[model samples]
Target: MSHIQKLLFIIALLSSSVAFGQLTEDPEDRRDQGKDPFKTQTVDGQPLPFSQRLRFGGGINGFRFGNPFSLGVSPVVGYQATERLIVGIGGTYNYTHYKAPYYTPTTYNQFGVRGFAMYEFIPSILPNLYLHGEVENSSIQVKDDQTSRSNSVGVTAPLVGLTYSQPISRRFGVNLTALYNLNYNDPQGVSQYIYGSPLVIRLSFF
Candidate 1:
């Protein structure tokens, strides 16, 4: 071939190779393109791994005083669906002791299961503030004063609330919430004390 023709052929081949490389994305980048950006990014803008999105935590509530004492524990497992949302399932167990100066003391045991969801507000004026909702069903057993027999009752409670979260570490956070139970006033409900007081405070960790 003539020298001029050979130089033109080499230039054309090199140009085609460069174009081909530019058109094909790296395999890693192609894989990343399928991922949801909101799910992958942490609050600090770092990429979060799928395994790290699984979270486990719960909370304890109640107060122990002279006349009436109560204690409860709830444990949950949750998935971080997105940077702004999380869903979880949990179980609860509680013990209560009630007494008056002139009346006999009564003790009761309660157990429940719950499902919950939380969504954080965007452009969050109060950082990490979220709206929370939950549905729970509980069974309670108490001994009758006259018959000395145990009576069992069931209650379904659905609650809505607001939560404030504080991140303590990359994988851990603490949340405080004030919840109002919607079914607390149900006519068929047997839980009078809790029904009369519908507002509940919850503290949780995740």
Candidate 2:
């Protein structure tokens, strides 16, 4: 099996074990006896349990002076490292083009690796949402000849965001995230830059 499949299989085994123990501890219980141990979190029908997923998305932002346009793509693959904690590695690339009446057109590019972790605060809620945080190390470069000269910014900008995930079906879901700059240290010291959109909508596949 693939790595993700193996992980899901292992999680299934663990969850089944816990379920079996719970059943054994109280064999006389009638309410929880007939239910499937691997029951899913869905209203229409029981969807398949999800321990991992892959998300892809792109968008534009208004961070620039002249409503600069930006496009990016991220393939975030995540695994439930534990029941409450998930870990993932992903890469992102963003290219921003700027144009203004009083300023020269410029393009900024960034590429970096991303890491994510989440904690499930409540398990009773179906399609549980997680309180998430993330960190990324990006190599930022700018190409602007009309502006003054300064040192290039090649430092890491760390950010933290809250992520909410809701599974719509067995293999489809939506993830909304809001991120902010946690370490506001600009090497060039000319701007307070935000790393990502205030609200991001991600469609995921398992």
lDDT of candidates 1 onward, in order: 0.73, 0.54
Q: Give TM per candidate.
A: 0.72, 0.58
Whose lDDT is greatest here? 1
lDDT (10s digit) by residue, model 1, range 38-78: 44454335556656677889997544455567777889887
Q: What is the per-residue lDDT of model 2 for residues 83-185, given as tens digits with 9 covering 90 to 100?
A: 4555677776766666676446666677778777767677677445677777767776677746743234554545566666665532234666656655554
